[model samples]
Target: MTPVILTVFALTYLGMILGGLPFLKLDRTGVALLGAIALVATEAVSEQAALAAIHAPTLILLFSFMVVSAQLRLGGFYDWAARRLGALPVRPLVLLGALIAVAASLSAVFSNDIVCLAMAPVLADLCIARRLDPVPFLLALACAANLGSAATLIGNPQNMLIGETLHLSFPGYLAQAALPVVLGLLVTWGLIGLLTWGRWELPAGVPAPSVHSDERGPNTAGHPEPGRPLNRWQSAKGLVVAALLFAAFLFVPWPRDLMALAGAGLLLTSRRLHSRRMLGLVDWELLVLFMGLFIINGALQQTGLPAQAVAGLAAAGVDLQAPAPLFAASFLLSNLVSNVPAVMLLLPLASAHPQGATLLALSSTLAGNLFIVGSIANIIVVQAAERRGIRISWRRHARVGVPVTVATLGIAAVSLWLGVGAP
Candidate 1:
């Protein structure tokens, strides 16, 4: 049973690192699902145990927020925001700053991936229309979303998990994280601006209208075209609900999952937006991925191998309970296995330390900017841009992502050192 559990754990994470098993149609989500299924089928863990392993608060909170994000997307608020921001008559640098501000703020409350998904296409169109290069703006969108999401626990999925599992004070974590996130966003804008100072215009040879698509709407040559116009009533309703939920998370003693679920239920009951449409926008694949990883990770913990491994590492002077090693490990493993899974693997060690939750949230979220695969928000932005014939290659992304990551991580390390004292 030990060997079987170890093998399943190894294979599941290997799938995460490789993005999937070779010669199989399985993606990371599929691989994770299979590992959980194998555990139950072999009776290594009972069905009841497997079911109990899942953390319902995290999943419920995530699902509720997804519903809230879907409401905003369906209401066209994201698209409208992008267009409105881009339409400003400011200089290129001013426009860039505005885009980052809006992207980061929205992502802090809403899911970063969904924000990127809804905004990418509209931003591409805006850039093309303004005759400004779309690449820098797109990179800023992805990078800012990842950075801003670090400000609060609800900003991204991994943060949400850490917050729920550890029961960290939402306001306390925000104070710890606020400086790093804000500084990071500023550094991102500066780097992108420096790299793209004179190169802000679109290449002379590319056709302008090629950037338009039916999903967003048509565009004439070099003219601002509308995509999804603002649904004022629906947008207002979603904003009010989101504002109330944010208040509940901050001050109220109500369970976050219940508060979020209640907010989602209110949004779902809208007569204007169909339930099917709202539900369709939900990322069910991501939910399944979380469930699968929870079971696989839970099963592995039962075998006590993780405990032994940690003891072994500590014996060798590689103490994960200390903040520094945990921070480094979080950053590296986050880029390797992706943030959510990496957080699950490290959460136990982190939860035991004084400021581990802050370390986990900051390191994992910031690491996403290292590469395209490091975060779902990055992938969402890249894919959305690709569909519009605006290519953001790996080399192109790394040019900005690498520096931004280094600078932000440096800020985080210094802040954490001062706040928690050295380990």
Candidate 2:
């Protein structure tokens, strides 16, 4: 049974690294789900244990926010926001700054992946319309979304996991994360601006990419119609609910998951937006992925191999309990297998350190800017641009990603070392 669980876990994570199995249609989500099923079927983990392994609070909170983000999309807020930013009558560099600001702010409240998914295509269209190259702005959108999501526990799935699992206070984590996240966003803006100087316009003899309305993909329920008026009322409703939720998380002593669930309930009661429509936009696959990974990780933990491995590393002078080793591990593993899985593997060690949650959340997220595969936000932005006939090769992404990651990680390391946000 140990070997079975180990084999299943190893294969599942390998799928995560490769993005799928060889010659199979199973993606990371599919692979995770399959691994959990195998464990249960082989009696390595009982059905009850598998069910118990899923973190209900994290799933509830994640699902609730998806509904909230859905409401905003349905209200045309994202489209309106993108258009407003693109239409700003300022120098291209200044416009890039505005984009970084907006993307970061929205991502801090909404999930980073949701912000990118909702905004990227619209941004690509607007940039083509304005005859400005969309590459830098798209990169900024991805980088800012990743950086900004680190500012709060609820900003992204991995941060939410870290906060909830470690029982870190919302405001406490915010205090620790705000400085590096803010500084990282600014650094991202400066790097992009410097790299794109004098090359902000579309290349000579290259026609603007065509925009097809239907290419927005399956999650298009709330996408804005070209001539449709912004639904200010619906947008306001979503915003108010989000604001109240944020306040509750900050001030109220109630469970954050319940408060968020209540917020989702409020948004679901909208008269104009059908419940089906709102629910349709929720990332059910992500929820399933979380559940699957939780079960797989839980089964692995039961074998005690991870504990032995950590102890072995500690014996070798590579102590993950220390800030420096943990920070380095988080950054490396995040890029290797992506952030969520990396965080899952490292979370058990978080309790050993004073600022483990903050360190994990910040380092894993900031490391995502190192490559396109490093974060879902980056992938969303790139795929969106590709659909519009704009190609952003890995080399092009590396030009910005490599420097932004190095600078932001440096800031985070220094801040953590100086006890800037230490509790």
Candidate 3:
């Protein structure tokens, strides 16, 4: 049984690293799901044990936020915001800063992936219409979203997991994370702006309509193909609920999961925005992935091998409980297996350290800017740009991602050393 669990765990994480197995249609979600099923079927983990491994609170909070974000997407708030930013009569660099600020702020409160999904396409069109190069803006959007999400626990999936598992205070985590996130965004803007300074204009070879053209004016180009028009009432309702939930998270002694669930309930009962549309936008695949990873990881923990390995490492003078080593481990593991899985593997170590949760959350998230595949928000923005005939290759992404990641992680390390947001 131990051997079975180990094999399953190895193959599952390998799938994570490679993004899938050879000669299969499986993705990370599918791979994770199959691993959990394998564990249960082989009796490596019993049905009851498997069920117990699934963290209900984390899943509920994630689902609730997905609903809240869906409400905003369906209300056209994201599209409106993108177009408004694009239409600003500011200098190109100032516009870049604005885009970064907006992307980061929204991602801190909403799902960063969803924010990218909603804004990227419209932004691409706007850039093309204005004869501005879209690549830098797209990259900034991805980087900002990732960096900003680090500021709040509910910003990304992994942060939510860390906060719920560790029972970290929302405000406390915010204080710890705020400096790194803000400075990271600033670094992203500066690095991207520097790299693309004189080249902000679209190349002559790239085909795009002129800003003065009647057929593809800035206003028309920035507006995404008519989806849901902005519903002030629905958007306002979602915002109010989200605000109240945020307040409760800060002030009340209630369970964060239930508070979030209640907020989602309010959004789902809307009259104009059908529940089907709102629910349809939810990332059910992500929910399943979290559940599968939970079960598989739970099985691995039962095998006691991970504990033994940690003990061996500690004995060798590489203590992961210390802030510096933990930060390094979090960054490497996050890029290696992606942030959520990395956090899942590291949470046990974090449980013993006073600042484990903060270090893990910041390092894992800030590390995501290292590559295109390091975070889903990056993928979302890249894919969205590709659909609009704007290619952002791996080499292109790494040029910005590498520096942004290094600078942000440095800021985080310094903040942690200074005992900011220390629990």
Candidate 4:
């Protein structure tokens, strides 16, 4: 029974690493959930143990932020930003810089995926109007979103997981991450600058687009009505909750997860939007994905994986003491399996240093820029570009991805070496 459960667990996570099972219809989420159910049926883990392994604190923090992001999305704030960015009267190069900075900055504070989802179409139309290639701009969106989310603990799912699991200091993590993040943005700008010049060139004296043309023209009958106007009052309420949540991170002497849950609860007391509707907007799929992975991984841990795999690494004189091997391992796994699941798989080994957790957070999150599939933000931008008759081929993305990943990871390594690891 133990071997059967361990094999299923390994296969499930291996499926995660492969992004899905071959010749099968299910995705990573389905694979993980099924793995957990398999453990229960095989009696390797009791229902109680399975439930315990699915840490509720992590789930609450994840769910609350999803609600927060959902509120911002429903409020039309992201849509407004998209249309406005589309209307900028700047050169393609300058526009690319602005797009990257804005996208990354917004992603640091909110959900990167949501930012891309709302901004992609607006950017697409804007590029079409300017006769400048949207491909570079869309790629900038992906790269910048990944770069920006690295700046904050609440910025992305993996960072949040690392924070809860490792008990990392929120402000300190930001300070440690600030330099790589800054250098990353600059490198991001440079890469986008080069790409725009060579691949996205438009003939000189082609006037920059006017704001009107980029606005997609006053509501055409064919286009769907703007997903309701930006709800200022609801938006304000959500913002207040967000501000309080951030304050909780800084000054409040409570678990960050509970504070976030409180803020989410505050938003739920509205008379207009149905609570169910608001909850429905939360990415329950992601939460389920996390829970399933946790149970699957927990079962693997019970199988003496450390003695089998980690001890062998030690036997080969490979040290996991500092961030060197761990960093390299995480960098590869993030690209191989995606960051969130990678973090879940590795967090068990990083429970030593107060900064170890933050290291796992930063390395996994930033390593995402290494390739197109390294992060969802990248895919979102590419898909959005495709929809607009633009194409951001993998080769085009790699030109930017390689340098950004190398530079950011270098900074992260040195930071860890010098004991500046998120203390």
Highest lDDT, which number? 2
Tens-place lDDT per residue, model 3, 293-384, is 99999988988888898889999999888778888999998999999999999999997877889889999998999999999999999987
- Tens-digit lDDT string for candidate 1 (347-420): 99997777888998999999999999999988988887777677889999999999999999999988998893
- lDDT of candidate 4 over 1-423, digit per residue (tens): 678877887788688777778888878888888888888888888898898888888889888888887777666677667666767887677777888889988888777877887677767766666676666777778778887888888888898888887777888888888777877788778866865666575445544433333334334466532233466877778777888788779776689999998888877877887788788878777888998888877777777865478778878988663567778778888998899888887887787555677678778988888888899888887886665455678887898888878877787777767766344
Would you give me the overall lDDT of model 4? 0.77
Error of 3 at 145 (Å): 0.3
Which pairs of residues clash in candidate 2, taking residues 3 or more apart in a chain or in different chains?
A: none
List, residue by residue over 121-201, the lDDT tens digit for candidate 2. Answer: 888888877899999999999999999999999999999998878788999898988999899888899999999999999
| Alpha-carbon RMSD, each predicted model | 2.4, 3.0, 3.0, 3.8
- In Å, residue 353's CA in model 2 sits off its true spot by 0.7
Ranking by lDDT: 2, 1, 3, 4
Q: Residue 314 in model 2: shift from native, Å? A: 0.6
Worst 10 residues of 2 by lDDT: 219-228
Q: What is the TM-score of each candidate against the true structure?
A: 0.96, 0.96, 0.95, 0.90
Q: What ranges in model 3 sit over 4 Å off?
A: 208-228
Write down the lDDT of every candidate, Cα atoms only.
Answer: 0.90, 0.91, 0.89, 0.77
Lowest summed lDDT across 10 adjacent residues in model 3 is found at 209-218
**Residue 319 in candidate 1 has what lDDT?**
95
Q: Which stretch of 10 consecutive residues in model 4 shows the poorest summed lDDT?
A: 209-218
